[model samples]
Target: MVVILGGSLAAACAAPGSGNAQPTAAASSAPALSSAPTCGTEPVTMKGYFETGFPIAKALTDEFTKQHPNVTFDIREDQFAVITQNAPRVLADDPPDLMRLPQVSELVKNNLLKNLDEYAKVFGWDKWPPSQLQQMRMAPGGAVRGEGSLYAMGLNFSMTGVFYNKKLAAQIGMTTPPATLADLDAAMAKAKEAGLAPIAQFNGGATGGLAFPLQDLMASYGPAAPINDWIFQKPGATIDTPTNLQATQHLEKWIKAGYFWKDVNAVDYATMMSRFMKGDGLFMFNGDWESGNLDKQMPGDVGFFLMPPVQAGGKQAAMSAPLTFGVGANAKNADCAATFLDWVATDTQARTIGVQIGGSHPMGPADAPMPPIAPGTVTESTLAAGAKIAEDNGSMDFIANATGAIYAKSWTPNLQKLVGGEQTPEGLLKSVQADYVSQVKGG
Candidate 1:
């Protein structure tokens, strides 16, 4: 009855999760949102590639077409693992008109994307928030703040939180979602003792489901030095320190205890979610964006709780990387594409996609009145304003973004071993650090 990872839908009409408050109050005078794009007469065919099979991606395609009736659109969807893994090959062969990428600066550093700062100005881009502009800065070797010329625009962002079932919790004698790290540990133990699979994770998406958050927690409790060092390029950085040791040590405890799915890292996306949606796994952790997808998958039984802090101040924080983080530098229809991505910020696009699919808005509240999976389910936005949260909570960049994603790509195998108790966290950390350092030195 138990297998992979999962969660619920955001009911917020405007907010990201349960639709609460705007992260940054825009100056109410930003043109009341664009009057929806209207360019049917001069339609241009644009090819766009992004993460695979979701309502938002499809909604984006539909909404863009609605305003630009004449434009023939070519949309490509795939997993981040595949596309980023084959970034060079994809760019060289088809050279799509536009691409959805992470860390636009990386593209600029590699000279793969075109700079859109000037064009952004002509498009009245300043009306957009500063927090949004940070993605496009033109700084070099910026391991921190993702500095580089603005070559990308994130459609919206999602954060990590706990997804649980209240009904099931009560059945298992565990009440609400666990709030503290120790609470989490206790809840997992209870679920297992009750013969219910407690924490469900898809190991195949290890880079996201595991590696990304584990490292973020490492930054939360231990030295901000290693994480901060990546951004500021601190000297003599080492992951083999106490910070990583502590993070990995805690993780091993859970791994050994059957808190997460065995061979979780080995599970594929389809199987993982399929089992999860069936209520097989008691809790799952992921971005609020999954609200829509999870709603479709599991309906009424799903709910989200902020990522519990590892320590006292660590509660309700997120471990996240923005979705749809890029635009093609040499995009033939750069102007149109840039404007479209930017509009996604204020427009009803994210909400609409989430609404139809039962998701959380990337930046807005999840108060939208939508059909529920069960008679009584929480339909709230799971997303908070990405920019604001990053600043207030201290954001950490994934190693993949640094060192050109080599570690992100290689992490799954090692993590699978770690979670399975085949590799010690210390051992895994040492090898990864050594390999990363060698690569960085060569540069």
Candidate 2:
């Protein structure tokens, strides 16, 4: 996302969209000081199903149990695909207290999630910025997201961008990361000449790893609102636009230039990451969530940067989303689950642990400081990129989140076709847009 460093970081450390002033005025000033709602000392055991595994939730629970010593958790972690696929059965048979809800609109439509409006009120969550509150809302019958009553909240904020191997960049005679799309092309050409994979990619399993960058490039050409409107399935929104076509053409151009790994389609996520860590590639187009792993495996050698703007100094935009979750309507410990969910925002210990362990931006109130990331580290760099996105309000939801089945049904397979020589950029976009039309129209 595009952030002028000073303004973005300032916004990150204060209220988003608010002009300079007190960083700790709203909810951050007042801790979790609402009524002492009780979940009893009966050893409240909550079963949590998550798309994200142990680290984030575990950290929160570790701190949460300190306040409510009677609470215990039985958390079941799974890959996003598995949890999303099983959501129906899980909800039908016996639902966990906290369930990662990817198809939040669908569940809300089915009335399977506990409406969080009451909890939002009790926690004083209305005090947060309007933009954040909007993301959590959905209209009655779940026909629309980004408005109405709250259904879910993200555990941690996330950002996506390019992760570059600084050492590799320097070896190619690059003094700094690219400042524009043209600069990126030059760097890629240089990396190619140096026998480096300019873009470390894996399209064999999921196209999101590749497609999201393209989407970000498209976003850079226009305002963030249209992209967000399309993703949120806003009325009259269309993805078959000129700028997105340019983005798709650009992806094809990179493919033809041999910028991506030749065997990218055969590689998997783990292998792609392993290769990037081993310095086999100059750049990896992905997200900040991977910062924790890169920090562990490739310390000091890596850095993160947003895709340069289309022009030398234009605004940048990228897809971002909260690591979202919901309470099950049938959950036994629903009250306890709501309490835990509320703590993610109101509790300082939870916020600190979220940043430190998850490399996540905060989902807390305006006055909350950006995570105390250290200087000159990749984590700090990524957080800076994220801070800018927040500051500029440049982030839009991931396009894949547009619909429950869009990734498997549309994004990945169509992108694979585009890169595999079976589809034109225009053809591929039409194909994906067709699916969106069908989904929205119930055709």
Candidate 3:
């Protein structure tokens, strides 16, 4: 059973049932292969559009082409900011076999995406963690997520956490990672006094850098049900509360204490990450997806840890979302695309390559080997941290995923003001809540 929050909301629209029976490869009208085709000799080419996650996609397609010499792929990769708003416009004129979905509800409502439920059954994807599956299901009319028709699947999965600089941590008289939020606070203060930025973050364009940290911290303060409900757009859910207020105020306090980069407002994500890679800060609030870059640039210097609990050894949670992808309604080679999607979950090489090169967890067989980890490497620490989150079942959706407009309409702007000393934390929270009510709730 899926461990989704808001039982009523999940139950509002029923998911089509698939029992414990395996489905055949020729589950749809697609031609069945003779001699058990690992690849077919058909002359077909697939087009795709994506924002990030290209490494995993490229790896899969490259390997697949080796198996079938006639198959080819032409995928366009772009920065997420460029394609997010223009998804619909681009899809209308130039549809690909697969594309990254930025506005799921909008795309679903407009019939722009193909439902993956049939493919999900054919692939027996139900065998994966139901929680992961839940993230892809969307109710009719796109009013609810986590149930109904399947629309997307993640190429890779990631969880948000704190990335620390070992050299800087020790320079501040710290020998071990923080075991609690209090310890993290003290370590940041010490790092600041040591003339290094405590947290290298960017809130200038998208506030995810700060928002994720605040959400991770808030996870420790109360039951995750309420928070998850709000993120899932449960009708009565709200983020206006003591715990969230405290989380917001905590970020404001950090900004006031100069814990963030001095030019945080002016700095964008690329610049902030570059600064952190240069060891300009003690900790960077980010996701495990950055592990690949860190592994390449500062292999032995960086490490990862989820935000510790309010008290040591308490339950921990982190904002996690799949690096999701969807099929276009007008996809030319969807059958082959489905094969590629299923391969990620069934083929060991695809799964391993995704983890090793993409720096993310795999949804393959349960017994799949964890990627080899090197001592003092970001990959080692991040994989370990990701394991704990999975063990605890502490994954939650990104807060921005609550609605299509949440990030640009509220979060980035309000958070900019909060960090700029132009808006109070409470004011920022209120503004965000207003956006949720307006866009998600239609209030």
**lDDT digits (tens) for residues 234-258 of candidate 2:** 8888888998898888889998899
Best by lDDT: 2
Ordered by TM-score, highest first, the candidates read 2, 3, 1
lDDT tens digits, residues 142-250, model 3?
Answer: 7777678787888877777988888888788888889998999999998878788899888776554677777887887765667877876766888888998888888
Q: What TM-score would candidate 2 get against the native?
A: 0.88
Off by over 4 Å in 2: 1-42, 52-54, 206-208
- Write the number of the candidate with greater TM-score, choosing between 1 and 3: 3
CA shift of 127, model 1, Å: 6.4
Off-target runs (Cα >4 Å) in candidate 3 are 1-40, 206-208, 441-443
Q: Pick the candidate with the highest TM-score.
A: 2
Per-candidate TM-scores read: 0.75, 0.88, 0.87
How does each model score on lDDT?
0.58, 0.78, 0.77
Candidate with the larger lDDT of 1 and 2: 2
Cα-based RMSD of candidate 2: 13.7
Candidates sorted on lDDT, descending: 2, 3, 1
Full-model lDDT, candidate 3: 0.77
Name the 10 consecutive residues with the lowest summed lDDT in model 2: 21-30
Alpha-carbon deviation at 331 in model 3, angstroms: 1.8
